[model samples]
Target: MTPPRRFRAGRFLDAAAVHAAADANPRLRRFMRTVAGHGDAGEVRARRLLEHIIRHVIDDVGDLHLGNAVARLERIAVLRERIAGILDHVLEGGTLPEGVRVEALGESFDQLRTEMRELSRPRDGIVGDAPLRLAEDAAAYADSMLREFEAGGGAAGLHSEPAAAVNDAFRAMPADRQAAVRRAAALEPQALWRAVASETEGGKRAAVADLETRLGGRLTPDELSRLRTAVDDLGVARNRGLQVSQARLAEALARIVDPELRAVVAGGDVWLTQQLALHNPEALATLWRRFRDRGGRADDGPGFRAYLRHDMVTYGRGVLGEYTAAFSLSSIELFLKGPDANVKVAGTDLVGIGHDGWVWLVDDKSHRATSVGGVSALTDNLVANLRRDAADFRDAITRLQRDDPGFTPDPRILDAISRMEDAAAEIERINRRGSAATRPARISRALEERRLRLRVTSAAGEVREITQALRDLGLAVEPTGAPVPLPPTGGR
Candidate 1:
């Protein structure tokens, strides 16, 4: 058979009726409190019992099903009966009657009645929670009863509440159900108060504090405080962000490298600071999670929103430090690829593609790249190679002019070469300045010019022009007037 279809309208009406009953009677508070502490099986059973009680309580006192409801209550009345059995067993064991059997069961009934009354009452808005006073009271009362019973009768408190609770529970039902429920509740009054109180403190505050600290101040006071109170109550609520800014920083720290890049990154505190500066909270959160989960790498750029005024150079260097040696080698490789491509030199990582290049070799942590013969050694080597290539090109051009004097090459080619040389010079100046902000424009433009030349200029012409350009641009070039040799392949 299909489970009962949830009638939204009926549920709404039923809820309203439950609210009405709780508001009108104080006994509902006791009932809810008792039911809360029940074990899973007991709680489930109690929930069913409460639902039945609520339906009966509101079922017009004269309903035809009233008699059946009373009979049903009698069938499910286990709490009182079970406690009575325990009390009898304890007496038989020759163990002095511990008040726990009395107080615990007694308070359980009290809570049941109180909760029932609270739920029965209606409020302006539907208040799912009844007052917590009864739970606290029940707990204290249960504690006292257990202690007295443990002492063997000197302090066995007379638990009048269990009988009263059962009485109240039945009384709250339709009047027709009360007599039958009363008859079925066969609880022993002597051992109803015996119960072990549970401990509440769980050392969660320190754990919460430690977690919050690691979050790098990303967690709000409200969020941290909420976690500190109870882990079970945590919710994935909107506006309640889980702070992971520090985690992102740690991630970013493991990926980037390059000194100039490090310098660019060092000026700022963290990616989160950059994010805050941009005033983009969503981007900040996304970058944080990405950094935390994927790590800080150049390829991971898609996940992290670049909001830094300095191009997140510090963050980049932190990431670079993770593979400092690898990045330095890669920098040299890039610089060796071409003389005209913009090259960025910073820390150990070299960025840029041509003559206008930025070299970044991150050594912020190791500080090795900044030292002499470190990244600077690589830079000097690159400059010297450019000089050698220039000398070779000049000699080749001189050979062509001599061997084929009739070859009056296009002056436009020479002009283009001259322009490239000029750009290279500008790039060198920018490099000396070591300012990433002022360099990209010149570097980017030079590469565009180089690309144009690469397509338009002759190979020999390009080599000749680039070498002369390098020499003119304040770099150490090979001696002039060197002899030019024929191509090794004898093919221009």
Candidate 2:
């Protein structure tokens, strides 16, 4: 084995401890039981799948680390993969035969041995035999399997895939030798995998002795089925873990960016981060740079420097809420942008709604609300446009109700719009009252107050009253409040 690097010893030891505990913990035993419930076929398949993942992580990602934590991670990952895969497969409604399981486990053990050897390899110039430690560990595991096997005494009972398969192969050769093969099989496969997974100093030896004493053999169909069920339960555990991982990773990654950007990006203020995550990590990095530049970091001019560095972590959570809202808004955008033939927009009041309500004003391409338009007459026009659009919507709904067999115009929506139109019409009427000779700029405050107190009799009533009050007072109603507030009665 290669001499250990100074940097690797602690982590390696840590990994070893975790792996060992995981291999023998009662939790894993229960986990196996849950997988067994999935059925033997599924458990076996899951084990195989887990083996594949471990190999990939270790060979690919772990190897990249030059036998540091990355390499250990590979082994750890594989072990977890084996455990989780068995659990998931059963839960997902898959199963494998006992023989199939034995072969799969054997392969996993072989790979683990190879990895442990590398892990034990000398980092500096020292030549240490890492495989020796693995072998010693394997022996303990073998003994445990033997004990477990002996307890069963070669009767058709549940054994790990490797143990069962090897026994089956031996039994087929000759009845007398069958018992010997079963005992040896228990020693070889189950114990080996257990040792590979086990990290406790002497746990592997104990496991092996247990196997030897158990005198285990091939599992019956029922045992296999139980194992499969147990494996299936693991899927639920895995999925739950995945959600937590995603949330944490998101939080961690978000920390690397500016606060406002994080807020806008995470709080759902903007679709930018959502878009960025969908692409590559590098793309997200680019957005981070741009966000900083916009905030004045690039030229050291007027950027949001203070916010970028500090406020993000502080305020990121609240912004995440905003981010969720933004996501919904985007969904709405798609409905508006797609198949215009099914929907259409026109007139002034349609444009009058606030930015949130002004669906069309929110840009699909840039993922931004219309920012260029000033917040004055243009806003008024937009509101007016919205009002008009509301009217149009009412008409459209009415038309659909009348023409389409399946159409049913929602009464609540229609009523809401009718109320809005009535308000607008009332404001217009009130404003017109200003033109009358007797009342022109002459209406008393008492009368104006009385008007404000009057019942919101219909949708048009409030707007009319406001318009009339403004014109009579010689004040610009449009520049003032466009939609007058409903009285204490809740409507004008």
Candidate 3:
């Protein structure tokens, strides 16, 4: 028989609710009470009571013109039991018998559906209303039972379509084996994908052993290959979603004035998108306005600069919050832009060597001025920034060791690391003594030793001190002409 027609709109019941109602019926409850009263013979008495309820209470009640309702309820109860048995068997890793026909299950559902509709029809008198209400309750209970059965794979038990091959193959196995397969499939598909993607030799071996144990048998070579492919596909799909999100963020950052800043924003776009989507969606409009103002036509220079500084603080903090092991080196005000490369160097923002040979240099910046009380504030800020940069340099070395064992540090990186350490020490000494005379010279020497090129924009006044300090270090600085014009803003 075809499965019960889907209900239009009505109250639905779940398996537990249906079972509870069945057990709570007045006649069933009285029989249970009497059985328990027998003390030592309770189990035997309960079984006897159950049989009497089925034969007497249910069968005898039919003579009162409730035969259809009684019969439908009995069939529904039996079907519920069968569905439960099937689900329990599958969940336990057991398989079904080959070519099993669940047509009777479908017929039972259809009968319950029909009886429920009939019982729901309006009754003329109070006496008629009582039976009608009971029938309505039974119908609702059956609907829930049907829903639970479908969810547990009962609905797919008799499908003949090719797409249902997995279900058919599952059904053909022994009940216990079918349950094992279902349990394995249900074991967090996303987690399984990650394990397959990131597991090391030992981890992969352990994962394989665990899977085999759960499945109750060793997978054939072909089966293992197919499973791995499925997991890889899931991982690829997840990465695709991330890339799409990143692209949207990149589009948003297009109006940023500085090429170096734009690149940095792009690098962190994935993390930034997550932050905006989850916490600060309102911040997007502000960020977009800054982007739009940076288009070559606008002369909102001071406002744009202020926005950049604000973003440096807010976005920098957002990054730090997201990455537990994060440390900031320098704010954007101090970033020495590269003359030729689109990248900027500030000390270190995030440092790691990719699978590719290029070493990563990350810098975080905020608009907040470093100096508040003239030279003293400058000294304190320089010292603090140098110390943080030194720490980041050290972290980069440690990461290199972990990622590529026996990897030697590049001479340029090693020299920069040593200079950063010395700079930190000198700046700290100057800060403590409240001396301004040696501050610029010491900072200049450190910048020179690091050999960083500075990007000179048309807004040279913004970085005048930084440029002079670099010049004192004897490094040649050149402007990268006017900032490039940004494309027209696109609608989100």
Pick by lDDT: which candidate is best?
Answer: 3
User: What are the C-alpha RMSDs, in order, of all predicted structures?
Assistant: 33.6, 28.7, 30.3
lDDT of 1 by residue, 1-492 (tens): 111223222222333234334433567635744764563433223333444444322332223233333433553366456656666877789553555555676776775565445434433112247432212355564564345334542211111112232333334555334332222222311011111000112223333344445554554565444433323222111001122233454444334343323233323433234334234535444445455455555433333434332334434433343333333333233321222211233322222222324322111222212112222322334333333433444566678899998877545434434444454565577678866664545555554555421111111111212232332222221111222221222110
Residue 14, model 1, lDDT: 34
**Clashes per candidate, residues 3 or more apart or on different chains:** 98, 116, 22
The Cα error of candidate 3 at residue 388, in Å, is: 1.9
As a TM-score, model 1 comes out at 0.16
Full candidate order by TM-score, most accurate first: 3, 2, 1
lDDT values for all models: 0.35, 0.38, 0.41
lDDT by residue (121-209, candidate 2, tens digit) is 53421224432221235556446544544464322121122433333333344443444334444445444345323322255446545
- Model 1, global lDDT: 0.35
Per residue, candidate 3 scores C-alpha lDDT tens digits across 1-492 of: 112333211122222222233343776556655765675644223433343223222222333334444555676677677766665766686664345457754665676576556555423212454543324466565465556544644321221112232234344555545443444566533224223322233444455455555545445555555555543333333332423344555555664555544444443323343334334435544564556756722344334444544555454443432132122212222222112221232233333332322222233221133211222212324456556765766787889899999989776556555655675676466456744677556655544454432222211111222335534433331222332232222211
Weakest 10 consecutive residues of candidate 2 by summed lDDT: 452-461
Misplaced by over 4 Å in model 1 are 1-387, 410-413, 434-441, 449-492
* TM-score of each prediction: 0.16, 0.21, 0.24
